[model samples]
Target: MPADPEPTAAAAANAAESDGAFASPTPELWQALGWAPDDNQRAQFLALQQQLREWNGRLNLTRLVEEADFWIAQVVDSLWPLLPLLRERPEAPLRCIDVGTGGGFPGLAVAIALPNARLTLVDSVGRKTQAVQAMAEALGLAERVELRCERVELTGRQKRCRGQFDLALARAVAAAPVVAEYLVPLLASGGEALLYRGQWSDDDQAELDRALALLKARVSRREQRELPAGRGLRTALTLQPVAPCPAQYPRAVGVPAKLPLGA
Candidate 1:
């Protein structure tokens, strides 16, 4: 018989916790996604979870707060894009944005998951942005993590923010076309957007394609997966910018949602 494989980071952490002051690591969580968080990363992740739970009262932050749901929806879903990005472009440093980051699902989670990936979490809601800002500072990520309380359209208009991101993400935010509209603008040339959806449709695809063309982006890849423990179905559509988004893009606040370019 073959010898046993070495222990996973979580397994090692658990072993250490029983032996010394090592804290429990959410190994199984990252393991499901083929990534492992070290002791320090795990500590930060745990702290982020606690803060999310505590702020849930006013922020109404996450619907996936139950233990299993939290791990699958918030943790795994947030970092799923990172693995693909790292695998595809191993050497690129990340400058990311989470559009319409209500309660900072993937934005805040991504900051904790990939500490080196600088993140800007954008939300139109003041309360949500304020809460995330406080949490970022409390977690000692104030410098690397920024919270913007404004419409996504406005951010795209600002010279300082536009075209500065390597990656952009929006989860459960809006229809695909609208999301592409909001994201494609903030991305640097060659940047990519990850649109997380619960369902995919031809109509959605057509609309997104039409919308992205206007914005100089295109859907380059799509992945579908069902979360573990019957959490439910999910998909991530990756859009690559062929060129820069026209200055006209992102339109105005409420336009993308109401008129919905492609759709």
Candidate 2:
């Protein structure tokens, strides 16, 4: 991946003038994470917002186009769960896949923050993938990002993608068990899967445990953080492969979502 572009005069002005909810987070949030965006990263984030706004009218990519909403719900929400890895090895050359990456939330935001990481953004919808591809190129991230407009189940079955990524992420994609099936098959041994959920309950964990048993994986960590401004609680569950996932996993194109593991 290439180095981030230098912040232009216009970008600096925009960042400096922004106020209220539109403004970047106070230093405390980023400080707690042990990472902060430099001028170049800030510029890339602004560019990403602009791209989402421009395409959203036609693509209906996301409703959170307002500056404040985008910053909190999209940008911050995406990066917060990554605190551990970002603080531990900020420059690791990680291979990551975002399954069902509608409008490329965490995937595109991640590419901006982690310059050394390569990303594969997958969504079943072709239009969404195409829009995300354009956004990646506009942000000068095309070189490091690959777009796959196919169902994640198929992606997990493909030789080039199966057991290929150091990290797999899925946010608001499906039920925990279904998501486990989708993500576990794509992780290389020793790799981790992060599931971003809005609300996690004991019932959810129990179902996921049953699913992981079939996948030869186990939950490695679970953490929850309250989004700023009371947007709600967010839970991130990390799963590590105990053994190779069975080949039958990820079932058929719609099976995981329809029937789900542990169902």
Candidate 3:
């Protein structure tokens, strides 16, 4: 079994004391989630926030640099989708990949929650991946986190990328179908892809349907919640790959987004 995640008391304390878009979740939010970081994990989260701010000035990794915004938009948003997996308490270590990991949002944050879960972060931007690579190294997470500065389409089509993950994650990146094209190729058969979005509409579902038909994946679950600090709405669509993706999928690099399935 993977080792238990220890808490970071000092950082957790600071998290509890602050209030802002970047402030840690309020007491109520904590209660609702029924999960809280231990002393060590809280320290990791603290370190992540600091790195995000420091790198933002140089790499412009994200606009959500303020503490409160960072927590709500990047940290918490990344962790929430893993709630189901955490609840299961699986004994086996997991494999997870984050596509289009701009500055390593859900990928790095999720790594903190599931320390044993191998994390591969894929992004096309060299500087962004460099920033995340440096930040992960600084946090001493280099052992667990893998960085790739490549387009998802190219990575997804590679032999090394196929059927490698228990979970594939993409956030604030693309519409549902487009996300499926980018995510499904990396997931193991029966594994899941979690697509993060701000809103879910009937049209979006319809669009997703067309894409799923092509991907041989299906919507397994959909979750919606108000973000902490009332920043905005958040939607997570969980899709399970029922079959192997067609080889041509993920298409040539830059193709999926431009021609987006179901478009």
Candidate 4:
């Protein structure tokens, strides 16, 4: 009989706490993501997680506090859907903006996995941005990243960031239609936006469908996969802008959250 295959990094990490070495989040998970961090990177990741845990006790930064969840759900899972983009632009210097990056999902993990890419993490809440800044520093990524504490709709007028990013990413921030309105304008022409949706179904496609017609955006790829958490499925809805958004989109503060476009 054929021997069993080696366990994947995710499988190994979730093996069992009793297994010691293979259990919990480890550098091996990063290695599996094709980002075989050196000693420094390994240390940085560990330090960031510890600090996040510390801060979470006070601020409730994230619901994922366990080590295994941090590694698989936050780190490994976030980067999995983004591998296609990284591969296509392996040598290209790209700028990515993660909007409403609460506790920094794809933003922080993407920065760690793709050191060459410049990341701008934006959140309106001061405390969230503060945590993001601290996390970036803890990971020794201060130089490679930028943090913004501002509303997404108000950011369009800023010369430094207006239409500056090559890609935009958001997770569970808002409905796809609203998120498209918020992020598509930030992307350079021909660039793409990635929206993460958890409760995706034939019904959920309504949001994407509405955005495409109204926001001059089109879905390039709809990737669906189960998160390492095993509790829910994630859909990476990739949207490309075919034309500039009407100036009226994104409305004003609290508007997008209250009433998504095409709703």
Per-residue lDDT of 1-263 in model 4, one digit per residue for the tens? 12223335665356543233323656555555554555765666677688789878878989875666677667766777787655675556789999989998779878876768889999998998898898888788889889999998887556677677888989878877888878887878888889887756655677667866787778888776644434345678788888876667657877877887767
Candidate 1, residues 1-263, lDDT tens digits: the string is 12223335665455334321112235555555667766776777778777888888776877766566566667777777667654454445589899888767888777766667888898988988988898888788898898888888899899888999888899888888888888888888777889998767777778888988898888888877655444455777888999878888889888988998855
Task: Write model 3 residue lDDT over 195-252, tens digit each, in one string.
Answer: 9988677788899989998988889888776555445567788999888888889888
* Candidate 2 wrongly placed segments (more than 4 Å): 1-34
True-structure lDDT of candidate 3: 0.80
RMSD of 2: 8.5
Error of 4 at 50 (Å): 1.6
The best-first sequence of candidates by TM-score reads 2, 3, 1, 4
Query: Which tens-of-lDDT digit does each residue in 28-104 have in candidate 2?
Result: 44553346888888789888988998999898999987755787788888999898777788789999999989999
Best by lDDT: 2
lDDT sort, best first: 2, 3, 1, 4
lDDT winner between 1 and 3, please give it.
3
> Which of candidates 1 and 2 is the stronger one according to lDDT?
2
Error of 2 at 92 (Å): 0.6
